[model samples]
Target: MNLLGRGALAPAVPVFRVFGAMNARAPSASLAPDVASRTALAVHNIEVVYDHVVLVLKGVSLEVPEGSIVTLLGANGAGKTTTLKAISNLLHAERGEVTKGSITFYGEEVHRLSPNELVRRGCIQVMEGRRCFAHLTVEENLLTGAFTRKDGRAAIQADLEMVYSYFPRLKERRRSLAGYTSGGEQQMCAIGRALMARPRLVLLDEPSMGLAPQLVEEIFEIVDQLNRNEKVTFLVAEQNTNVALRYARYGYILENGRVVLDGPAEALRDNEDVKEFYLGLSATGRKSFRDIKSYKRRKRWL
Candidate 1:
């Protein structure tokens, strides 16, 4: 039941470990060696319930250190999205609420803040499925992320260009309707829009869903660039365990609304249980579909 006690998971492929050795950037606080002291966001034993009835999240707790990438990994329906929505205060829109515990951003309690208030505090969420406005031009969709800023037009425009620098493909498609762009381009737009907010923390959900493998790598590479260059912290919820581990410094695995396993990303990559269950690998090698199904029925951490 204690997966963290196991050996480290396998390392992600070479390309995915591009930023694995970079040092953590100092936040507003004095440089601290430990993650706890430098945490940008902390979710402490929070529980989320939908419509005051269906309990969705049960004591979910995780942290994202400032200027670091931390991933939440799990299968579909494992409460990854709910955890993100809880942090961004978007739960209220869906009739869901965090019924207990606390969520803090930059050490201030924020579970009660409005979604826009959270955004104003430099925290934002890019929802899954590339939620771009169908009728809006790609450039228009990116600019909307700046609505909360009181900063003048020059600053916002500068940030827009910065977004274009990171996502040149988006600039190429800027005049096109977001709904007309390819899935990968739309995903880039969603993230580009998040960048326009100048957020210190971005809670990204399922960024790789429905994109080709190459596109997934391209997107994550941009994430790496943003983290290193912009000092933006990311708390990513992704089903693509292999790619997520490659780019993130740390990872948490969720199941049925609870954190089942967590460790440094390299450790998670080499973990046998993670490889077997999430990555479809075992000590013996890649698992066949039948083997995976059989193994799933008897998951050790379940």
Candidate 2:
């Protein structure tokens, strides 16, 4: 007779219980192997205040592993940029303070370091609006980023070539005044300047803002390539969720100075709540998928 009570239904209760226990044990025996760890940059609970009266960041926490691109998504005045500034220590420059919590860069405290000190230690920020010296030549603007280095001229020249390789258009405008180039070209220059610092992580603020569609695509492509090939980490603050999510490995959604949602890029792409709010989708609309697609087409044209 089978132990499963096949013959005359012998001890049906005991046989079924034994089979169930064996089934559970089989899966436990075939468990997946352990995974090697990935290097991660951790941001603990951090808070920022402006002028000792107004608060910006409130108990924000996130992480970016090595060789990953992270994005902070938010609408206007949502403290996304403030979080980037706090991470890079730019808030201290403006007398805006980290009133609470500590920041660790590669497991070391970063809140106490000066901006220049941080740059030397491999962290840099490319501010919003592509702030470049308009009258300066492209080469000069790039040279400014290497002021901290005492290396000889040939090494600096090699670094410039590497930057130009990443942004070929910047090489085409190498001798022109930054003011004379188009908006996209200026943004490239700003990023190239940041790269000259030889930073492991670059805090980019609104890199896609105020640019034409083609240029925005070009810039995002470069950022993606850097993360893939150069192993450069990124923490970008962007209003354009569609573009930012395309390049980021992970993302955090900020609203009114608080992190309301955060997860892997693939997860957020499918999240209904993120689509409704940050991705600018109509949560209650009854439009069909075709209609939604048509609406997005119109938005791109506009």
Candidate 3:
């Protein structure tokens, strides 16, 4: 079954339609790695314009190394999703156009490639919402992701089984309509569907959104597992800074559509400005309150 012909399995949401801007700031050194550069994907000075006038992305730049997890963190309308769209070249409706900069994938320039071509060339995106077919069964949805391939039935079947292995709940509901499943299960189905394409780099957008805390943890664990075990690189855009930072080896902080900060995950985790602003930590008395409480407890005990 040709997935595109049926339209039943077509990606419902536009793959990428990123827009918006972030606040301006200086780049910090703690975020930059000292080791030799290794970029699986690089977005260099890219600018996106809507309707050939209003600009959304402003000179955004970041890199994802081979076999590692990198995250883009920002608030809503920070152009996180737009950045993904620029990579996939699906910037329609917003009349979104990339006027400046280029996106390179695996050392090849991707800004000129068509959306379908990009998918065929080893890059696939698992969109923000769990946009699985509400009427289709889980098995059908997974098969749809592989529509671009012309492999034998046996290989597709094996891959389908692998998806089930990674997400057992998807197997349990293989025959069930996607709409009937819970949010987390739908998310699993979405990711499983993307994996069917056998991508070299997976662009994950807000995979943890709308799930419970436990489910969020599970999702991040799966992401980490894919990077470690499958050796598939990832560039994820997430609103949940803590979860993304926890799993990502490197991170880029976007503010007003620009790369405000870029660095290793550990450094972003400990940065004072990042903690105070992006992570919403109180810089003035973050530990002071805890220390004061501890001292009071010790005095009473003594």
Candidate 4:
């Protein structure tokens, strides 16, 4: 059964152990504009813990600009999803908390807000898996995303039409139960549902997981289009560096709950370490992280 139930909440909060500690950030109310300022979401020196003991994020920090796509790259157990959950305020659903540091959206302290409140504030997260309401039709599933809105029916209808326009496959499958749809369609449904919220920022977690390369390309194209046309900012957490970087303007690589490397997407694509280790194109043929004895820690990602 789909754990999140039959509607907007279908993608239940992910449960996992956390891993770090860092400094704090004061709250701010002013959202004044500045050409030098482009941040939409900021995770500042955040430290997350589980059961009040096990640390998961150690002084982790990053920024997502208001009108660009940012990619978070990492392997399993690298704290990528945990970081997303922390930003969405979904950690509390799994008995986790950001013990230190501050999370802000548009200069406002949002770490204190509830998950739904975060949604209300133009921040929404699409979970790693293609989680959809198995029992509900695709269109009904999309409507659940509007539950938090007080907007009139016309605006909601327009948004729904917009979602369908973005995912036409979804419109074709509107009457189909989400569980009965293909992985790609379900993934589209998940993203379309988030779009229904008319979010300014979308925290996309592994949209390429379990999908074919072509479908991944198609999905990302839609995401890129959404960013370009609708001006929605995206913070995508993905392991598919090849695809993620292709769409993102900047990239951050996480390892063991800390940022190991970060740079412009194009720059990171040409980075020796990224090419040799992540892209599997070493001079001596492809080598796994475990097989490379000389790949020492360049620096402690504090």
| Predicted structure with the largest lDDT when compared to the true one | 1
For 1-302, candidate 4 gives per-residue lDDT tens digits of: 12112212211332211211111222111211222546898899898876676667766788887887888997666778889999999888777789999999998999999899999989999988978989999999999988788898899999999999999999999998999999999999999999989899999999999999999999999999999899898999998988998998888887666676777788778876677656766677766557666545421111
Q: Residue 151: error of model 1 in Å?
A: 1.1
For all candidates in order, the CA lDDT equals 0.82, 0.75, 0.77, 0.80
RMSD of 3: 10.5
How high is each candidate's TM-score? Answer: 0.86, 0.81, 0.82, 0.84
Better of 1 and 2 by TM-score: 1
Q: Mind sharing the TM-score for model 4?
A: 0.84
Q: Roughly what TM-score does model 3 have, to 2 decimal places?
A: 0.82
Residue by residue across 23-98, what tens digits does model 3's lDDT show? 2333332244523545678888999877675666779888777777889997666678888888888776447889
Consecutive 10-residue window with the lowest summed lDDT within model 1: 1-10
Give a tens-digit lDDT track for model 2, residues 22-64.
Answer: 2223111012111242433567777777767566666777776
What are the clashing pairs of model 1? 8-270, 8-271, 9-267, 9-269, 9-270, 9-271, 10-269, 10-270
Candidate 4: worst-modelled 10 consecutive residues by lDDT: 15-24
Worst 10 residues of 3 by lDDT: 1-10
> Which candidate, 2 or 4, would have the higher TM-score against the true structure?
4
Itemize residue pairs with steric clashes in candidate 4: 18-56, 19-55, 19-56, 19-57, 20-56, 20-57, 20-58
Greater TM-score among 3 and 4 belongs to 4
Cα error, residue 32 of model 2, in Å, equals 19
